[model samples]
Target: MTADGERQVRAILETRTRAFGRRDAATAAAGYDDDLVLYDVVGSFVRRGEDPTGRLERWIASYRTGIGHEIRDLEVTAGADLAFCHFLVRISGTMRDGTEVGMWVRATTCLRRQGDAWTIVHEHASVPFDADTGHAVLRGEL
Candidate 1:
């Protein structure tokens, strides 16, 4: 049997992925801890901020009126209720103004286990891929 902390961290990853896949902002935000931190490749990074709902709203806007994202090569590392996930995201589609575009970014997120629940505390993402190579290169893949 998994310990509570471990289970909570795993749950966060699972729920976060599910929420993102379904474009459910509220559910996605549920994965965050009360003292949450997030790093986004396209948007602003939230540090020591209390509100994660704004990020969720941006995610909603992207799905509703902006680009769409595809996640791949997702790998999560966890110690008890604390965890981090790294992955490559491919974004494509048009902006609300009808400008078509596509891009890819790599990122990692940090999470904490809180009272049988998993919440994200910090996230750091960057576009580290090189055009010289065909695909995205992660920490170990490089």
Candidate 2:
């Protein structure tokens, strides 16, 4: 049962990643619960409820097209009705103004099983910063 839960949670993560890569906001949002809370890398440190959806939309809108995401070093732990996953992700794309954008970020997600489906209840994304300079170290490799 634990193995099954792990697989199901992995599938949900994969689906969400693919949806984001394809810039399909609706499909990406499907993996999250209605009461989802998120700590996003780009905006406010904490966002509650449907705010993550708005953030996602803003990100998608920034790309002219061809947005893509790659996940690395993913680790998942699952029990009967709860799961958690952590991973490093790289997102790359062209901005609407023709600027190239690429970033490597850390991600963590907590999921809850509702019936047979797994939904993200909480998520956090972050990038390390330079402690002395108080600036984001965005160029670091994954």
Candidate 3:
């Protein structure tokens, strides 16, 4: 990875990290492209440019506490105007109904340089599931 490119991309991702920690849907949404496509681990499998901030706001409201995220094994490949990264992230927090959730999910993000800044154009996140039971493994180390 180019040091400068990686540093810039990582900084952009840090906005998301902070957004998740603070439950700031607007901040999280601002880092994405206007026409972003996302495949998230919860609710919708795929979504396209459809009021992501509002969707995130509703999701955050379901949580009693700010969602926690811990990123690991991040790998970034950046070019002059295009970049992509993959990483593992742990999502954990309590729900409004008093349920505690913790899960390890894999994430991939693609970014494109828009003038002086980079914005995420596509993202995919998923949790592994058991083959036999077809149940998501929501609380385990990867």
TM-score of each: 0.66, 0.92, 0.93
Best by TM-score: 3
For model 3, residues 62-109, the per-residue Cα lDDT tens digits are 999999988899999998889999999888899999999787899999
CA lDDT of each prediction against the hidden true structure: 0.64, 0.84, 0.88
How much is 55 displaced in model 1, in angstroms? 2.7
- For TM-score, candidate 1 versus 2, the one ahead is 2
Task: Give residue 80's lDDT in candidate 2 (0 to 100).
Answer: 84
Which is the winner by TM-score between candidate 2 and candidate 3? 3
> Cα miss at 59, model 1 (Å)?
4.5
Task: Write model 1 residue lDDT over 1-142, tens digit each, in one string.
Answer: 2355555655665675566656677777777777766566655555667567676667557543434556777776667656777777666665556656466677677776656566777877677665888655433432
Using lDDT as the yardstick, the better of models 2 and 3 is: 3
Clashing pairs in 2: none
Please give the ranking of all candidate structures by lDDT, highest first, separated by commas: 3, 2, 1
Residue-level error in angstroms, candidate 2, position 59: 1.7
Please give, for residues 1-142, the per-residue lDDT of candidate 2 as tens digits: 4989889888887887888778887777888888888888866777786555666788899899857788899999998888999999888889999998788889999999989989999999898989999988767644
